[model samples]
Target: MSHPVILFEGVGKKFRRSLKADLLYGFQDASRSLFRRKPLEHLRSDEFWALRDISFTAGAGECIGIIGPNGAGKSTLLKLVNGDYRPDRGRIAMRGRIKSLIRLGTGLQPMLTGRENIYIQCAQLGLDKRATDATLDEIVAFAGLEKTLDAPVRHYSDGMYARLEFSIATCLPTDILLVDEVLAVGDIAFQIRCLERLDSLKCNGTTVLFVSHSEMTIRHVADHCLLLFDGEALAFGETDKVFLKYYQSIGYLDRQLKPLGTSPEIPADFAGVASIRALAVKGQENAGGVKVFTGQPVDFEVSYFASVPVDSAGLVLQFWNQADILIATTHSDTDGHRLSLKPDGGRLRLALPFLSLIPGIYRVAGGFVSAGDWLGYGGHLLTLVVAQKQGQAYEGLISIEAKVSNAE
Candidate 1:
């Protein structure tokens, strides 16, 4: 059998991002807006190339992880491979079945109940009635929402919504699995179960390709790595080597490398009306020491001084893999919770209880708002890094507590 189950031969994807002459349309619409008017995102100067001249291969049983900074085309490459987007150039060849878990329950009807959604989601995953029924109970149990399974999905919390998505997608498995940060959707316990499911599939010879900003996720599940920089392959080979290259480039090991802390470092070209303050990452317990591992608790502390009292203040933390696409993010003021940073002073801390983060360069940022406004707290606030040492293994993020299930 051919070792490579999935192969990308000189694949490239280009997007037309144009500035409309009409102030509202930006340049993209004004230039050739008459003939081609699709959203010209991922374009540079009305023409952006998300992926260009990219080439690589994954063995039949290989699990390759894609990592990168934000807007680096990590997700775009998965989309291209999943056939959601056609490559501008090059070809993609796959030897087996392909399934993607990018956005779970993307087509779910909010008005539908969980049971109904189970059917709908199963059908979406190409599962027939019989197959869905076979796995229905397992899914509900895995989701731990058997009681709420009959209720309208609209009332489900964010975690519940995520559970339904995970159950529906993984009930029936496939080869060449493509996942984009979906593992981080559900809570920690559910995430563990989901990872276990994926591991089972991997052991069964399923070839998986995952894209995420979470180094721990990739480290736990992937055996190989492909580091993407600005939408192109920066490094590809043994997962450890590629991750090392990522850390080296991001200056993770340097103690002087101050990430976006109270105030993130911004480019001179950016414009905004806000100020950021002290940003520091320290061991949750030590608060003064460096060198943190996956299980060790850590704190990404941000203290910002707001000029005016804002009703809504949001503090968003983005974890970027070596490649730069955000793998996981938790925001303080995004429908879940919002706090006010008074003119006097306010501090917001994004805590990682067990630092489930795998060994990789992790970037941090502090985005602040006061009086219910987004003037610009400080974009890309700061970056912190974690290193992967050989023979070292740690569970990604908070390891879920579990007990041995024994026969009665």
Candidate 2:
């Protein structure tokens, strides 16, 4: 058997608490905190253990995904491997030259142009200027920033910066790579290219440590899996089984989505906004919410928070067949309010009066926006079962409620 490329043994990280310690004292006591021995001392109480005793291993050519809910320490775990932070206790072992996409432009020079930054970055990674020059065009072309490569990086857009940084960081033939959800940086073509590159690299002997909340990407790319929760290892093993367990725990499938062995998944929930943490479909347990029936007054609710308030927020919830086509979008909220929601943390709540959805495990998808940016995402919120028998007629989608007489 081959040796593991990355091994995490009892890895853990602790962060000093933030300034909320003095909150214990009432608002009136805020004045006393100014003279306190150490203002940061107050922050000590907010101390959080970001990652707990985590243990895992990945061999050459293997990609392992780290997943969990927000604040689950998924990011911290990757940072630990990337050498961003020192674990208060425990050790991590690596087998190859590790390239971390933890930060964009790790060695970027503020006053440098994108061209200079690229060369400097290459040199720092141990490449000669000649080697840097050779690969420079490929990087620029891949980033689709040929026009801006000579311009100052200060003028680069966030996506452009991501592309440049990613192209630079990944250009080296490192034996191992640590990646975040950096694929969200470029357009779809670039994204596909990057994924293909990762696959190509993996086939050649590089190990990948991927961090994402995307279960599908993980299931698609990882050979082994690690589930993190509250900064601790919750599960780790073969990707298929472990990810399946994760899906079940997250309510993706209940004992196999009822109808038979198909795990529920949300491929594109927010098709327009900046994306969301996650989403699910549920109803009152006692209300027989187990499986939804067609023509039933079922409820569809999408919940998501923004990293920053976008200008607009909306969704295109499309129910797809197994082949994946837009059967229909049951709801649309484009009243001009979703794009300009006030308050950064505001969420949109949309309710459909009567659900005229056809059953057969229809997948739901739509766009969500806050202040006007779209989150390119997808997936199934829930698999509803439309009852074959027409129980009680609803006064909506099926038809408007206006009586018709023979005379009419």
Candidate 3:
């Protein structure tokens, strides 16, 4: 039987909060190791567990996505897998060559030219001169750095630096790949190229551990997902099921929206000036309904309450796909129709002439802004489902009516 390419068994990592504590712990660990004594497993006053009792496995060619809010130890887990940090406890075992794209400008020398740095990075990755030569043009082309290959990396823009780093890391194939939000660095076109490269790696049987906050990117590439919450493995399983578990446990999909005419639970900071009272969306055909068929019109309404009268307030609504991708955004001020807020609170409705959204679950978020600053905001305030009409075969997140005919 083939062995798993990546395995973690009860892994845990600890870190100190302050530099002084970190230095003290370093000395203590050194002394303990020098004396052949076991290190302390308990947390110190200034230390905390970044990862605790995490366990998972990935077989060859499987792409596993790690997701969580910031400070969830996702980056720490990737660092452990890449051998940059040792687990305080438990075991992590991996076989075959591993390449990581965790940090921007990793393995890059600012003083060296881009072309020279490429060779240095390749050598560090254990690729010999001949191998670097073979892939040199491909890397340069992929990075779109043909014109600036001889320019010093110190002069490269952030986007240029990220593109070069990504190109170098992905120029050659490896048995395992570890990525952490590196794809968010470049422009949209380059991000697409990087994703396509990851797809190519998957097709070529590379085991990948990707860490990102972008749910759409994760859902697109990952077969399995590991969710980390406060340094604990909350869920690990199929991508779809794990995502559902995450959103449900985090109350992302279970928002209990207050009925119309009721004021939102406004915080003190947002109370005096203005606040969002309630939000809702309905189909035009079936008014006040949440479900709608593709190509149908939908009405979005947001109610607001103001302690004092205000002029020229902005109301914005954003539609996010199930994958957490922001599909569309509409602003009331964009069309030069700035809304005025009433002290007693009032509802404003915006209509979409043609929904054009594909069949899928969607989330709506609202924002209320006055005099440039946001007075109040709510996320995941409303959920809407768009279903495909019977006997209709449509593909993709939105439908733009296209007329197709053969010129021949």
Candidate 4:
């Protein structure tokens, strides 16, 4: 791809669990080097591979998103690229100048005023007085810290520190950028500005390596993605494909729905009146669970038993996201549809011509009510996993159809 701006071949990094082992290994490695002995290639006791055999390439103007669970070596990879840590094995090649927003207040002097720290950081980034002076106002404005620009950085809050750091780092143009979840500290408005700044950088032919846990953000910004699991590269390719693989690797297919809360028991007065037996995706059944893609036709079948005929009954289906927040719900009577259960039990199917849910895990629940009183409630009866539709650009918890047109 036109001479990659960054390349990593078989890169591996290790760390000792304790200070004692670190010192011991440091001395042993130094001794081996002094005696012209080969360096240790295998891990020793109390040592573990933080990253192993990671290889990827990034060309100019491309943003590669690194994602996985915590301790997946995402930050480690960014540090290696930023030269904060050197790989013990393999090689990392880079072209052009690089800037890192890897940590909050990383290069700032806490004892110095924000105004002074700005100059110092700019100098470190290879900007002279005239250059830093030209962009100083812009940076201050972007950080929204003009009133407190003369205050010591130690007095600043986490959000203030993040805003200032991000503004300074991205104020000047560079060939490569490394961001590691630092934008999360800023407010949503600032985060949006940072995304715009990243877009501008990409337009200037900058190669970016971004690490974050928010899949929606990653999907919005990244051209490609790298998935890490337990210090290894599980998948790396197109963002959508990698995300799908990531969900699968994390047991999303086999993940069980957690109970929303204490499920309401059948009231003594209404015992055996009606009960929800099962809730499942009509046509998508597998050993792991139910899975479907975005925009695909879906049918949810709710199985129930009615001990006695119920003249008036209402059925409700709920969809909850991973955070247990209710996203969407449906009721049989909402559209003037009556749900009358006969003495015999049967299954009711709710059909959707096109599912509008975005790709993620969701919990399906069913409830039965008669005349505004709940007869039975079943929560988290089924775990529904929605996958990204190939070549679809929609994101967030749900997808909606919209069109953009020019104003008359």
Report lDDT (CA) for all predictions: 0.67, 0.62, 0.78, 0.81
- Candidate 2 residue lDDT tens string, 266-328: 443443335543444544321111244444455555555555555555665666543443445
Better of 3 and 4 by TM-score: 4
For every model shown, what is its TM-score relative to the native structure? Answer: 0.57, 0.55, 0.62, 0.63
Report the Cα lDDT for candidate 2: 0.62
Tens digits of lDDT, candidate 1, 17-57: 44352354444356656677554433344454577657788
Question: In each prediction, how many residue pairs overlap at the backbone (N, C-alpha, C within less than 3 A)?
Answer: 39, 47, 0, 0
Which stretches in model 3 have alpha-carbon errors above 4 Å?
257-408
Local accuracy of candidate 4 as per-residue lDDT tens digits, 46-70: 8887887788899999999999889
Q: How accurate is candidate 4 locally (lDDT)?
A: 0.81
Better of 1 and 3 by TM-score: 3
Off by over 4 Å in 1: 1-3, 19-45, 255-408
Cα lDDT tens digits, model 3, 114-146, are: 999999999988999999999999999999999
Model 1, residue 359: distance off in Å is 18
Task: Kindly report which residue stretches of model 4 are placed more than 4 angstroms away from their true locations once superposed.
Answer: 256-408
What candidate 2 gets wrong by more than 4 Å, as runs, is 19-46, 105-107, 254-408
